[model samples]
Target: MARSIKNPKKAKRKNKESKKKGEASSSSSSVPSMPAKVWQPGVDKLEEDEELQCDPSAYNSLHAFHIGWPCLSFDIVRDQLGLIRTEFPHTVYCVAGTQAENASWNYIGMYKLSKISGKRRELVPNKSNGNESEADSDGSSSDEDEDAQDDAQPPVLQLRKVSHQGCVNRIRSMPQSPHICASWADTGHVQVWDFSSHLNALAEMDAEVNTGATNSFSMDPIIKFGGHKDEGFAIDWSPLVPGRLLSGDCKNSIHLWEPLSSGTWKVDATPFLGHKLSVEDLQWSPTEADVFASCSADGTIAIWDTRLQRTPAASIEAHKADVNVISWNRLASCMIASGSDDGTFSIHDLRLLKGDSRVAHFEYHKQPITSVEWSPHETSTLAVSSADNQLTIWDLSLERDEEEEAEFRARLKEQANAPEDLPPQLLFVHQGQKDLKELHWHAQIPGMLLSTAADGFNVLMPSNIENTLPSENP
Candidate 1:
């Protein structure tokens, strides 16, 4: 035992000397310059052994993903979501992050999941077949890396990281063209990327390296629009418009962008200058492809006609304070919801806005509602996120009882001690996050929704609700 201990000390000294020699030799050789960005972005954080608090029972979805981006401020992004397309038979999310204090080095990370638990056998792919079912136009996962597959340990199975430039404010995967996505940044630029190109190039590079051919990962943007004069914070790709994209900047200017026939994106010369203050958010109308709405810090929501840049079709004072978020009902052509800084949300019906546009007022939130979205699968279902760590999924299908409402109002008029009845519209109330920053309804998945905040992210589509499809009655 004594000899073993002494030998370890001697071995440590000799190892230190050999490591010094190795460093010297490496310095002398024609070493490749360190790449501008580290290739592995989220590997360290993803491999960090932490107990995942999200219970699988709360989510029936198979492909839900969690992206942990360590950003300094909460200025990551807001009001944008397109369901992530997985490179494998799983749900995937890519988050662009930087080191906690080092804002210059940004990382875009992807986490792929696999399951090994006995209970989750049905949820995960059956690997006994020995064939994977995922290959993308961008070549994200290819046959070249077949040997790289490892035994699953549950939860997360794979992770990849790529670096990016500028402070990315928002990223929205396009629905019509899944390969193309839009990214807006603080540098007043709207950039588009074809992930297929980036991922295909990466796969090809890996194949070359495996065959003893050396190369590097070079990611380039497919298109960039820099017409905004100030911070380009908001971007919304039209669900109805095939390739039309709408963007808003902090300088109260809105620019419409489209792909030209010449294979280039062009910004409209006549920018919409309707709002007097900074544009807070933008949402394309659900029913009309050519019509959309923009909420502003000036406490107004302006409806615009895309064909004419002359003036707004309608400008309604939707809030007493700055309107932070706006969402159109997927099923209702005239219903729109707006959340404001005054800790209230209003459901406005354009058909009934002749005098007062506010239809139903909700003050359940103690903080400003930062994000609001209407469910695509269920009619009259609205989800809103208050920074006060609450995500309320409300069902607006409740019918009011005339007698109950009249009696409650009479009790209020008499100042009698009567408890106000809980609105029947209240559905699921999710809480416990530090700050519920953003919420979105998945464009494709029925009843599915996603929310992210300081605590983490939540993906849920309540199964035990009256989720009758709108198509059933339509």
Candidate 2:
């Protein structure tokens, strides 16, 4: 059962007071108030008179904003935050492509989302159960400071848009050079652009006083290739090799992009043709430059090496339906996550492919999954968005604890009525968005995730999920 946010401030305060009272009273003296019941999204239905209620305790920080035109795809532009940011009052840079009413109205946008203020809520022990066990708690007094920041000034969304020829199907920024981005357009052309000038413009505007305005400009792509017989959605830049690229088309052909010293890319004429159907998504290996992975509409995933062009090194029958998306785990090279058209997502262990490659599978989303991404900082963490209008975060390291659940049920009998089917690995489920298309975790910010949909975009960070990113402590 998906719930919406009502008055987060009020809910936060109320939950805080209740927690204090519960903490004061002994477990035997008085029974603590039960929490809001949890329910599955597609399985549970709200009645006509039943309205959705927001649980403020569920989130640490949440904000929503829109661009004039909805974006079909976007990629976060890396900044100088040193890649493991844990602080707040955060700022983000990204590039997005619009799906406008007319082909000519479409644009590739560069954005600077600033003043996203909030701290990571601290988790306290749950004293209600009399057992010394840790559980998620409501926000502390520091929330008041965050609320003040919100009231004084809301988060800002600033952008500079460049006119494009057609609707963009997908867009990806080079990890090595974020200002350089590759976009696949519906016009059956793949184009690369240098947004250095636009990034500089946004940076300059940041030094000025506040003004609500969007800057627009016209620019041509640095490189344009129309070699694909049909449009495609799959495109990715090699992480290990700067400027190296792979683009796959609906005609089951994938082309390689090799950067030249002259600031242009040389496209190989002989395309890789291992997949028998449309290539839906592509991901380059995080560890090996020549190694990559691709998923297809034929329900198969192929592992390929650029050195051996024509055939895949290994192939697996990954899903029963079209594999729409795949995310290669950078922190754990052996693990890859894939989402399918049949509303299921699975984790594959490449080393175990000869036996049973799939280590984990989920059927949580009832609609087709549009996006799947592994958390850059956490090896066992992942975020997924689906056509069902929901974004979910999962922690693969978690598993069902029957003893803990029994203790929880004994303490809060009514509220602990979560269905037995609820996957323990699922950490959070975010709703209220319409037709959620894609979600990406900020590599700089530990727990924050940005999602795009038909209505607009949402930036959210859940309070309960712990930061399990490997320590950088000296």
The TM-score leader among the candidates is: 2
Per-candidate TM-score against the hidden true structure = 0.66, 0.87
For model 1 the TM-score comes to 0.66
Query: Which 10-residue window of candidate 2 scores lowest in summed lDDT?
Result: 5-14
**Model 1 residue 113 lDDT?**
27
Q: Tell me the deviation in Å of residue 368 in model 1.
A: 1.4
Candidate 1 residue pairs in clash (backbone atoms < 3 Å): 63-91, 138-196, 138-200
Query: For candidate 2, what is the TM-score?
Result: 0.87
Give the candidate number with the greatest lDDT.
2
Global lDDT scores for all candidate models? 0.56, 0.79
Candidate 1's C-alpha lDDT? 0.56
lDDT (Cα, 0-100) at 283 in candidate 2: 96
Q: Which stretches of candidate 2 lie over 4 Å from their true place?
A: 1-39, 122-152, 207-215, 409-417, 468-474
lDDT of 1 by residue, 244-363 (tens): 888888888988888777655788867788898888788888678889899888999999998775579889988889898888776777888999988789999888656788889898
